[model samples]
Target: MIDEQKQQDSMNNEPNQDQQTESSESLEKETAAATPQETEVVAEQDSVPEVETQSVSEDDNSQQQSTDTTSTEELQAEIQNLKQKLEQEAQQRETVTAQAKRLAADFENFRRRSEAQKEEIKQNEKRETLTKILEIVDNFERARSQIKPETEGEKNIHKSYQGLYKQLVESLKSLGVSKMRPEGEPFDPYYHEAMMREPSNEYPEGTVIEELRAGYMIGDSVLRHAMVKVAAAPESSGEEENGESEKNNSEEELA
Candidate 1:
């Protein structure tokens, strides 16, 4: 009976021992799963400090680039200012040069006008003096034509006057004075004044038949006009003359 009682106690103790072992195994598995989670959380916390330090470094670099950009902008502004100043100076110089050229051109034109005016005054004075001298020559010619030598002494005096007149004419001719003789030449209204129109067969129509008074010229300008007679168209025949007589008689009868 004591042996049977010891066997029953041993069985009950065996069941208690088995249950304690299962409980200890479950606690060990829970500790193992919690260990990996703690290690992961520690790794994330350590990486946070490194990320913050990198962000601070990037901010510093950006500030330095901003300072460099400010300096470059200032330099560009200064260069632009200098360029504008040079352009203004060049424009001012061009304006001054143009004004100087205009002044010089105006002065040159004034000088030319003054010279032309002086030359015109000189020509007018010369023409006035020459006209007075030509009047004196005309009087001398009239006196010579009216003079007659009847005695030997008067003949010598006339000859001496003729020599003086010839010398005067030569002097005037040397000074560009020239006499015009329109006789037997084509009539020029500018140089010749027609005193009468005479019908003639000896000369052509519109011809200067005779010069009653002398003409004179200096260069290409007429100084005096020649008093002249122009030739008219000749009568065709005796029949035309008789017709003109008959017409004149009819006109007289009407009168």
Candidate 2:
């Protein structure tokens, strides 16, 4: 009975040892598969970080390009505005210069016209003064003609006076002075001054009877009026007798 019990115990112990060995081998195989899967997840996470970094860099580059474009546009607008301002200033300068030139031209023309007018006035005044002097020279000629040439010395004096008179006339003519004596012309109050009134049978009423001093004019300006005698109608003999009776009688005597 003891020998049989020993053999049964040995057989039970061998089966238990083999079962423990099989359980240990199965656990090792499961651990090896889990380690490989964990390694693949770690590698995928690393690759995702690289992709995010690249995306951030690309965004920074795009923002910088937009900023550069904006700056360029602002510079262009400033340049355009400055160009317009310069053009406007140039145009204003041109207008001012043109106005100044026109004013200068007008002033020059006015100055020239004023000078011409002054010269014309001076010439007219000179002509009128010379006309008055010519009448005085005519009186000298008449006085010389009335003098008698009796002796050689008188003849020589007369010749000398005549020569001097002719020389004076020639000198006056050289200065644009000339005589103006209108005969058989109607009497004018502007040119003629009546010195005396006379009854003339030959001339009509309001006619010039005689010119005592000749008139003179220079360029339509009268220098001296002619001292003249005017004609009037002849008085009747009956009118002269009536004038004598009126002078001698008083008002009481006539009543």
Candidate 3:
């Protein structure tokens, strides 16, 4: 009875021991699986620096690209500024050209006006000089016509007068002055002032019979009119006697 009891007890204890051992082996297997998972997590953590480095490189490349874009925009802005400046300069050049042309035209006008003024002054001076010379010529002509022929020096005076007259005429010709004598010519109201009318058998009616004063022209312009006597138609014998009696009666009344 004691041996059987010992055997039973020993068999029960053996089962308990086997159960404990199996439980321990299962716990160890679960622990091992959890350990491998932890190792994998650690390895992933170790590779984090490489990923960070790659990300940093990408960020740097992006920053460089952004900087390049900013530089390109600045260059384009500079080109635009240069183009505007050039356009302004061209406009200024055109304005200056127009102003220069206006100034040149004004200068030309001034030159022409000045030349005209100078020419007018010269013509006035020449006209004054000629007028003074004409007065002297008139004096010479009166002296010669009134000289006495009986005087001993009259011949010499006449020769001197002729010489002076020739010289004077030559000088007047050079100065564009010409004498106009209208004796025995047709009546011209423009150049002649009729001081007397006379009946004449030798000339037609209204013919210039005599010139009391000679006319003159200077450069196509009349300087003086001719004092003239015009002829009238001849009167009949009875009309002439009547006219003479009236002229004598007027003369006797004035006396």
Q: Report how far residue 39 has shifted in candidate 3, in Å.
A: 8.0
TM-score winner, 1 or 2: 1
Runs in model 2 deviating more than 4 A are: 1-80, 117-136, 145-152, 193-207, 219-223, 230-255
Better of 2 and 3 by TM-score: 3
Residue 101 lDDT in candidate 1: 97
Query: lDDT of each structure?
Result: 0.83, 0.75, 0.83
Clashes of each: 0, 0, 0
Model 1: pairs clashing at backbone N, Cα or C within 3 Å? none
RMSD (Cα, Å) for all candidates, in order, is 12.6, 10.7, 10.2
Q: lDDT winner between 2 and 3, please give it.
A: 3
Poorest 10 consecutive residues of model 2 by lDDT? 246-255
Backbone clash total for model 3 is 0
- Point out where model 1 deviates above 4 Å: 1-68, 235-255
Q: Write the per-residue lDDT of candidate 3 for residues 130-192, one digit (tens) a residue.
A: 777877777877877887567768788788887998799899988898988798889988888
User: Order the candidates by lDDT, highest first — what do you get?
Assistant: 1, 3, 2
